[model samples]
Target: MSGGVDSAVAAARAVEAGHEVVGVHLALSRMPGTLRTGSRGCCTIEDSMDARRAAAKLGIPFYVWDFSERFRADVVDDFVAEYAAGRTPNPCMRCNERIKFAALLDKALALGFDAVVTGHYAEVRQGPDGVELHRAAAWAKDQSYVLGVLTAEQLAHSWFPLGATPSKAEVRAEAEARGLSVAAKPDSHDICFIPDGDTRGWLASRVGAEEGAILDRSGERIGTHPGAAAFTVGQRKGLNIGYPSPDGRPRFVLEVRPKTNEVVVGPKEALAISELAGARFSWAGAAPADAASGFDCEVQVRAHADPVPATARLEDGELVIRVEEPIEGVAPGQTAVVYVGTRVVGQCTIDRTVSAVPASR
Candidate 1:
C-alpha cells in the first residue's frame, strides 16, 4: 500500500476475501523525505508512515523494504541514460520488471508468502493452461500497460485486488465507510524521483549543460536549444525558436541526435512512425507460437495511447510490428504493449521506428 485510497481498499478487499495479506512498501532511495522542502512524491518517508497507519487500521503487518540501491541501479540510472540517448524510456515498466517482480517477488517467496500483491488497476485470472493478465474494469485507469512486463511465472503468483473496482472515488468511499486513514490521500504523479515536474532541470543538475544546434529537415541549422538532453521527440511548444514557416506553419521536434548534439524540427508530418522494432520481450501469457510467423493484434507504444490495429511478428531477434493506423510521437526506448481485448499478451522495448515520407518531387 502506498498510503493511498486504492491500496487501502485493495487490502480491505483482500481481507474480505479471507486471505492473510501483509503490506509491503518499497523504500526507493530517490524519494525525498518529508523534511525536504516540496517532496510530494510517492515512496517518501511521509507516504510510508501513512501506509503503516493504514496497515494498522486493517490489523495487518506493514514494513518498508529498502530497495534503494537496486532501484537506483535498475530504474533511475536507466531512465537518465535512455533520455540521454534520445529515447523515451518508461521507468514504471522497468520498476515493475526489475524491482517489483524480480527483486520483491523473490524476497516475498523466500519469506513464505504465496504471492506478492499490489493495488494496481489490473487483473489476473487462472485458466486450465495457466494464469493470464487482463485490464482492469476501470478502462481509464487501467495500468496493465506498465505491468505487461510480468513473466508468465510472475503472473501465476500475483494478485491485483482492485482489478474489478471502479474509480478511486469509490475506493475512498469504501475506505471511509471502513474508517481507513488514507481515504483522502492524493494519487502520485509520474516520475516519482522528480517531484517538481521539471525533468529537463533535474537532468541539467546531474549532467552539465552542453548547448546544441537545432536543425530543419534538410540539416539546415534554424535555431538553438539549451541541450539535446533537455528535449525529446514530438515536442513542439518549447523549441524556443522564433523561426516560422513562410505560410505561417508551426514547427515540431522530429529528432534528437546525441552524437552531434542537434535537435531537429520540421512539419508535423515528420512525426509519423509506421514500423517499430522492440527487444527484451516478455510475454504476459504464453509466447505466441506463431509470433515468429506473424500474429494480428492491437499494440500500444505509450502508456495512455490507445491500442491500434497491428501485427506482431518476430524477426532477427526483435518484435517487428506494422501498426495499421499511424500513431504519431513514437520514440525509441518506449514500450510496445500487445493486447487481445483486455488481456495483455506480450510487450517489448521499442528499438527503432519507420514512418512514411512524401515522395521527392
Candidate 2:
C-alpha cells in the first residue's frame, strides 16, 4: 500500500467492492538502517507500519515481502550501469518493469491471486481487441508513463483502484472517511533507494569520479569536470565553467561521452532533437499493425512531461520516434512512451537521438 493516502483509499475501495484483498508491502532494502529515515521513502519501516495499520482498519490480511535482493540486482545495479554508460535512467520505471510486475506478480499468481493491485494513477480497461492501459482521470497525477513497460500479459493481471479518481485530494478525503491514519501522510517524493534525493552524491560514491575535460562544440577545452557520468544532456547548472560565450549566451551540456571521458557543452540550440531511436520495445497490448510503416501518436520522454506529436514505428528491432516539433533534453537510457489519444501504445529505452544541430554530438 506504500503507507500513503492513495493506497489506503485504494484498499478501502477494493474492500467495498467485495473482493478479497491482502496488503503486501515490499521490503526493498536488506539493511534496516536504510529504512530508518521513514516516510520520506516508499520502502521505509514507517511506511510498512502505516500499511499494516491501514490493513487493520480495512480488516484485511497484511504481509511484508522481502524483495531486497532482486531489487538491488535489477533496479539498483541497472541504475548504476546506465549512469556509468553516460546515460540517465528512470529507476522507478525499471522497478515497475523488473520487480513489481514481473517478480511480485509472478509470486502473487503462484499464491493463487488473480491480480496484483496497486494505487498507481493509471487505468487498465478491456478494449474491443484486448486490455489497454490509459492515463488516469487525474491528469496531473497520471503515471502511465512509468507503467508503460508493462506487457500485455502483465497489464491483464494488474488493477489500479485509484485510476478513476479525479484527484489526489479526493483520495485523501476517502482515506479520512475510512478512518485511515495515513490520510495526511506526505507523499514519497525521493527515489526509494535514494532517501535524501541526492542522486549525484549517491552515484559519485558508487561510481568513482574520474576527472574529464569539458569540450565546446568547436573542440575547444572550455572547462573541466569531475566526471562525464555526473552530467546529463541539456544540464545548465553546476558546470563550474567560468568562461561565457562571446555573445554572452549560456552553455548547456549536449552530451556525455563515457568512452572518451568528455562532457560536451554548447549553446541551448544544440539540444533540439527531432528524432529518437530506442531498443527493448514493449507494447502494453498488441503491437500496432502499421508499426513498420510508422503511425501517428504522441511521444512522452519523461514522466510528467507533455506528450509531443510524433510518428512512431518499429524498424529492425528498434522503435524510432520522429517528433513533429523539435524537443530538448532527450537522453539515452530514458524511456520514450508512445500513446494514441489517451491509450498507452508502447514504450522503449532511448538508445540514440538525432538533433537538429550537427554539433550536438
Error of 2 at 295 (Å): 0.3
lDDT of 1 by residue, 293-315 (tens): 99999998787888999998989
| Poorest lDDT segment (10 consecutive residues) of candidate 2 | 32-41
- TM, every model: 0.95, 0.97
Model 2 alpha-carbon miss at residue 143, Å: 0.8
Query: Whose lDDT is greatest here?
Result: 2
Q: lDDT tens digits, residues 19-46, model 2?
A: 9999999999988665436667687888
**Span of ten consecutive residues with least summed lDDT in model 1:** 30-39
Model 1 residue 36 CA deviation (Å) reads 8.8
Runs of candidate 1 with Cα error greater than 4 angstroms are 30-40, 359-361
- The predictions' CA RMSDs to the true structure, in order, are 2.0, 1.4
In Å, residue 237's CA in model 1 sits off its true spot by 2.0
